[model samples]
Target: MDKPKVAADSPAQVELEEGKKYAYCTCGLSETQPFCDGKHMSTDFRPHVFTAEKTETCYFCRCKQTGDAPRCDGSHKKLQEPERKG
Candidate 1:
């Protein structure tokens, strides 16, 4: 499949409930930003299905480039850095 679209150049802080299932957007095409909204249906990508371990605010990756699936690893920070001159 092709590379995912960049939903945003930052993480989405969302409140997750313990024991609740969440479908995080992997394709970066969801209108829901960090959550899945069935936009991946046209692509090979599927939502990252996971259950919240605890009730708390969590940072979810919106750039779709995090090494840690469905979570932010500060990858978005690097993505927005100004390009170096040659």
Candidate 2:
């Protein structure tokens, strides 16, 4: 499979409702950021289905490199920082 684009190097803070199903964008091509907007139909990627267990704020992975699917695991921190030459 092709590598997903880096939508952002961070997580997206979103409010989730209990028992609500969410389709997380795995293609990183969704204009909706961390959520799926049916934009992955053209790609080999599929949206991850996540059901909220409780009503609360959660962080969703936008970088698409999280160890946990659809969740932010701070894996974006491992991405190499650009070198700065003085």
Best by TM-score: 1
C-alpha local distance difference test of each model: 0.86, 0.84
TM-score of candidate 1 on Cα atoms, chains taken together = 0.88
Off by over 4 Å in 2: 81-86
lDDT tens string, model 1, 1-86?
59888888878899999999999999988989899999899999999999999999989988888999888998776764542111
What clash count does candidate 2 reach? Answer: 0
Candidate 2, residues 15-84: lDDT per residue as tens digits?
Answer: 9999999999998888898999998887899999878999999899888889898889988887666411
What is the lDDT, from 0 to 100, of the residue 68 in candidate 1? 100
lDDT, model 1: 0.86
Query: What is the lDDT for 32 in model 1?
Result: 90
Q: List clashing residue pairs in candidate 1.
A: none
Indicate the residue-level lDDT of 37 in model 1. 99
